[model samples]
Target chain A: MSELWAASALSVRIAAVATLVTVLFGVPLAWAMARRKFPGRGILEAIILMPVVLPPTVVGYALLMLFGANGWIGRYLGGYSIAFRLEGAVLAAVVVALPMLYLPAKAGFAAVERELEDVATLMGANRWQTFWHVSVPLARRGLLSGIVLAFARALGEFGATVMVFGWQPGRVTLPISVYAQFEQGDLNTALPTVLVMAIAALGLVLVYNALASQRD
Target chain B: MKHALIRLVVLSAVLLGVPTARADSIRVGAAVSLKEAFGEIATLYKADTGETVEFVFGSSGQVAAQIKSGAPMDAFVSAAKKQFDDLVKDGLLDVETRHLVAGNELVLIVPAAAVKGGAVGGFDDLKKDAVAKIAVGEPKTVPAGQYAAQTLKALKLDDAVKGKIVFGANVRQVLAYVERGEVQAGIVYRTDAKESGDKVTIVATADAATHEAIIYPAAVLSKTEHGDAAGHFLDYLMSEKAVAVMRAKGFSIPTDPAPAAPAKPATP
Candidate 1:
């Protein structure tokens, strides 16, 4: 159905955007956590990874407080409202998916041979150059797998997205559509949407596994 | 290691046995709005009969779907007749046990701070430029949302306010949005508005003529093995004691006389 296709496309877009945002911020934060021995590092790591352990609804509620009209951050958006919009859904997905991406990316950074980075640095390469050339290439597979995992997680996100943006027609993702169909007792529609999501998720996991298993 | 494994198995068995060994239990699926009232009634029912009544609370549509999927619920108390009717049509519920229990009123609520300005008087005011967003449950899945939509349509304001609508998954979520001041106004049950304390103020009660009757219907499932117990629970729900509890929670008890309790079937 056209509705199903639209919902699937929207879900993919939301997840892709969320995953992109996650990687942009997560890679650097993960690298810093993995490579540094800074003070408060333990607390910082716990805060980054908190979403993984907390209930999705709790994360959603916290986001709601932070991004709501009366919220501290939301009040200063200068008349631009983020709640009940596609952007809010993306923000929700990023909150829930960030930890999933960060953890694996952190592990990837930690797994990279530090000696190679040091060698690159000693050869007159700057820190940023050494990181991109030596550290990133060595950990590319793990990082890619992490990105895939985060995309998959974001695609299936429901609790936080619902809490933050509710389920607007043009903004409803695949998971929300499936839930709405099921709740409306339209099993005919719900089952196929579920199947599509399941297959897509399986495909994502397969890609991740393939990338992860590749020998560098 | 072998002795410890045997001990662990024995411990697990004992833990699992504790509940099944006690009083007979029945699973009742009720709408989320009925949670507090039903929980109190459940406690009272347990005190009187020594029976354990477990409740599964969710949106009426979701609960009905579970019943259709053959959820092991002994009784279902729904916030809407459509869900009950659907189950009856599917032969999942005993038609004879179905009874209208209580009624609720839909109300428009605004954040407490907004009430002073009086900028929002009713559904028409929602079209004002100052009202940025309005929250209502998703009409496709929530009964409260259906009523809200009906009311809006009746007032001919559906088209005018269509763009400002934000749908919550359920009535409680709508209430939350209003309570948190995330939306300028929200539509929810009067009871839900009451629960939000000082955070929200009721702006108007939707006219009953605008929407179908907001009724709660209770029924026993045909698939229940504990038919007698389920029937008894249904009877208890109609009793004056339960009616009082429902009333206290802002529900209007049905005026119809209570159905006679069914005779308990002989246990094998």
Candidate 2:
């Protein structure tokens, strides 16, 4: 029973870290995508959407190649022993979860009326001030929704995390733990972990739907 | 869209139907290490006896767990004894049907590019700062990991080398790490090191005295509906015919107190 909670708790921690990291990077990227018309916007969008299209294992292996001890970046950082540890798992989760947060964030930012930003700018406000005071306030609902979606996606991400982390118990999170327990035929241990994930996932969806309905 | 959907449905149905048509087949769960070797034998057995045998292969821990959870398997061939003992405790194995069929030995392995000074010699050199990482199986679930842990503990080097340990999911995965040069060294079965051909070099033979005996055991499950067929399969494994296949794959014949394997030329 404690094992199940420990796994889920680690999953929650991963999702939280992924959500935080995504929003830190994603919102700005989304706003840039929404507001700026660049020469390679389509290519940029395609690159951002790559994780969504690729199999989770492919993403995981890519993460492994990038963050693994002998990986390109990992080689430079080998002195630190970055890959296959819990930190690598978090990085993998964030990579997989980025698109979920980015799509909704871009949509939310795009839906913000250009006139409001223009008016704020006309009042001598700078770009940053206009964004915070005018654009962000109007797109708050979309930002909130995207955070929920990102959290959900991160919670459910398995393949990439497992491929990189290799199911190091008490370190990697819920899904891999359930898989390990299931493969070991410890049903008494696995079932409760699965049930907890199910409930948490369900709770997030329900809350997201309720908030979306209220916003509507 | 509808035509594509119909094609998908038909494809899925055909896939599902093929396995169900062979309902009388005995599903035998064996270790991943035995996949290529046993797959060859199973094909021969089917042709010779006209009895279909289907095999599902993975880590011994995984196979044992699957059998315990009522995975509809008729028999189990495990790479380690602990899993078999667990099944016996669960009363899932037929008491009279059990036998030790094959044996494996642990060896240190390194990438072909790395072996120097006539192999690693012993565990002392493994702790050199130049040795950045050392791969072993996950100690909890893999037999190789258990043996590696036992060896390290016996040498009192477990604590000294704790920080350098990077776990592979199984013996094969450990071999993969060494083959790719992802780690400085790894521990895997002698057969794995041999079968890897030129990809990896055997570094040293881990002494059997350092760890528990590594034995492969086979048994028919008590729940097997086709008990007669299962018994015949077990008998066949012990027969000279199958023993030759096992031996050719670097497995030794099991004995009361397994003899020390003779040192041999490393796989070229």
* Among all candidates shown, the one with the greatest TM-score: 1
User: In candidate 1, which residue ranges exceed 4 Å CA deviation?
Assistant: A69-83, A107-116, B1-22, B25-27, B41-54, B117-119, B223-242, B258-268
Chain B TM-score of every predicted model = 0.86, 0.85
DockQ for each numbered candidate: 0.57, 0.21
- Cα displacement (Å) at residue A28, model 1: 1.9
lDDT (tens digit, per residue) of candidate 1 on B1-268: 9999999999999998886432479999888888888899999999889988998888787788788777778999888877777887787887678777889999999989778888788888998988878889878668899899999999998988888888876788888888877788999999888877799999899999999999988888988898889889888888889989989889998777444534444559
Model 2 Cα lDDT, one tens digit per residue, B121-218: 56777777777678888766678888988988887878777777877767788888778666778888898888899988886888899999888888
Instruction: Classify candidate 2 by CAPRI docking class.
Output: incorrect
- Model 1: clashing residue pairs? none
What number of clashing residue pairs does each candidate have, in the order they appear? 0, 0
Give me the candidate number with maximum lDDT.
Answer: 1
